[model samples]
Target: MAIELKEYIVAFIDLLGFSAMVQHDCERPKKEHRYIKVLYTIHLKTKELKKTIIGLEITQFSDSVVLAIPYSQENYKKVVDVISNYQYDLLNDGILCRGGASYGKHFSTEDFLFSNGMIDAYKIESTIALTPRVIISKELIDLVYPASELSKNEHLILESDGLYFINYMKNGNADDSWKAICKAIPDELSENPSIRSKHIWLIDYYNHQFPESKRKDNHRFVSPDA
Candidate 1:
């Protein structure tokens, strides 16, 4: 079969701090830290999500994962949903995700793949998405109704940088995810300032997700309704 170029909303998600985590886990007992299990779960979730969203395409390598969906507001929303769900699920395992998404020409096959869309998405992830968040702007927002969708998306937040990021914790309800972060956050926050900055950004993101009416003046102080 011949490969043809298609416009897609592409997302490139890199697992933040995984390499460091892998090195740290090297000394720990294997039973205590299931790294292989984490990898398997990532692939399994990709399969599950692709099955649900028929047009979604996923390519994963090591700590990086790429998703390309047909260019449409509907598919874009699904892309956001996939990332949000992935963040929530991975958070349970003390994994953090950060990346970028955009729209452009892309194609990927079993034996071969090349995409400007992937490159652009990768650039955004590496540069713009410094924190543990997936940011989007420019082409995608103009091409699709991503900007307009913001008015309706509970999981989307526009930062001072004028880019939109997925507020993955918007749906978090203090379940296992909170427990995982509750431990991981303190450990990470105590690290060197460079490392501490990113985790701090995540903490702020989590605090800002809930509805305005549900929270008090302070970030940590929130009503049960939040």
Candidate 2:
């Protein structure tokens, strides 16, 4: 049989501190269980969401999730929206994820995920996505929007460091959820040094995006070191 290859928008995501969460749950007494249940719930919800979104194909194992969607202008937008919503939902549930999105030819099956797209996505997620955000590859961005049209889009933000990530809270639709995620960041930062460091960019982004008046009365941006 000839192997099939087609263009796709691929996303590679990692559930931050998953091993540590499991370890913490194991070390704690049975009555104090929390992380495992939360992770399981998030996993189930993600699966359900992926099923509802047509054209999306997902494969998950342990703490990693790989999603692929057929490539087209409409499909591209749909994939971006799906990823943004998924990320927000996870954040609302007190779980942070970091990932990367790329576009290229790829192929997958029930037991296999193979593609240059997947490799590129993994590279971006592991390196460019140092914080709790999904970085988009330049190739994908250029394919979706040319240089002249880039600034007109509010859905994506280009960072000073030349990386582009979805602006999930853009346009005020997710104001309440964004605020909640911001407030929860400090507690998440206490998880462990690695997790805390990974979330520092999230904290900084929240501080820059939200004004003091919008912050919870008792909520303050806590340094990861604190």
Candidate 3:
């Protein structure tokens, strides 16, 4: 069959600490079976997301998941919503992830995946998205929502470094997920020091985006125990 290349918005997501999650379980006593729960959780959550979200094609392997959608305003919006929700859901389950979304030419199918779109998304996710946030490529932003319109968009925030990341806390009710992510930072900092700086950046961004007033119950930070 001939390869069919087309424009697509691709998202590449990596589960943070996945290797550690596996290693920790591997080193445990064989009879303890602690890793079963982690494996089950990942399976359940991915299955749930796939069933819940539509209009996108997904390919998942080990700690990475790739989602692709045909380029369109509606499709792009769905991509953003699915990715944002997936990130938040994972955080609530004590698993953090980072990813990148880009738009370009690509070929993807149930059994095969290849393209510059995938390459761009992977590069951004591995290099740029060091935190538990899905960084949107400027190429995607320009293709989906031009700069003039994005300036007034509340769901997306342009950081000081000029990269645009989704403000998952937007629309008001996502506060709980936002708080959960903040609460997870300290624990992740110790577990994964390589991304410590990115975690700090995420915390700073969260504080700036949701100030004391915007925060519920007059709390600046949620208790890790809570």
Candidate 4:
């Protein structure tokens, strides 16, 4: 006989810039130290939120966390609220989040266990750019009205499938966070011959993702949330 299973909501929460943070730390490893500390804090906060918010079970991976929650009306709101709150708190620390939430079915059989409907959720999530925000599938939007608590940037939009993805970027309150980041880099390394090559690569990445106008206005767009 096949084992019974139930529908569920899968929440994918991915941390942004873990590898970049480490790779760029050669000049000043202390900066990386600070980044790791912030990550740990975020982890603890999410775990606490899971316990406080009913019907949610939080699981963590190397640079991400996936939460499987009971599929229900109230549970959906809880998930959104928790994530929004999480992002809001991290903004001050210069850390942002990219995440997706969708309801699906988790199957359990005699010889196998698997999930369905999560594929759509992931598809919707893929459309979100590197910003702090939540992306919800069309099915989820139809079920509950999204709150206007967070503003959407270029990465936020409604897909053809009617799924709505919102990218939230906020200004970080950390003192000289960006400046401190730059200061940590040694001038010798910054002026290295290979630095030009890396800058070119960075430019290519930005150009591919952002329009020339947005790229030129670096002051305003350097950080989406800011």
Query: For model 2, which pairs clash?
Result: none
| Winner by lDDT between candidate 2 and candidate 1 | 2
lDDT of 1: 0.75
True-structure RMSD, every candidate: 5.5, 3.9, 5.3, 9.0
**Best to worst by lDDT, what's the order?**
2, 1, 3, 4
lDDT for residue 53 in candidate 1, whole number 0-100: 85
- Alpha-carbon lDDT of model 2: 0.80
Best by lDDT: 2
TM-score leader = 2
Tens digits of per-residue lDDT, candidate 2, 26-138, equal 99999988788888888888787677568688888999999998799888888888888888787777788889999888988889777889999999998888888899999
Q: Write the per-residue lDDT of candidate 4 for residues 1-111, one digit (tens) a residue.
A: 555567877767776556766556545657355566667777788778767677666667677766667788787766666665565565445554567777788653334
TM-scores for all candidates: the values are 0.83, 0.85, 0.82, 0.59
Rank list by TM-score: 2, 1, 3, 4
lDDT at 77, model 2: 85
Model 1 segments more than 4 A misplaced? 27-34, 146-149, 174-177, 211-226
lDDT per model vs. reference = 0.75, 0.80, 0.75, 0.55
Q: Residue 217 in candidate 2 has what lDDT?
A: 40
Q: For model 3, how does the per-residue alpha-carbon lDDT over 39-125 read when each residue is reduced to its tens digit?
A: 677777776666655657788898898888778888888778877777767766667788899988888667878878888999999
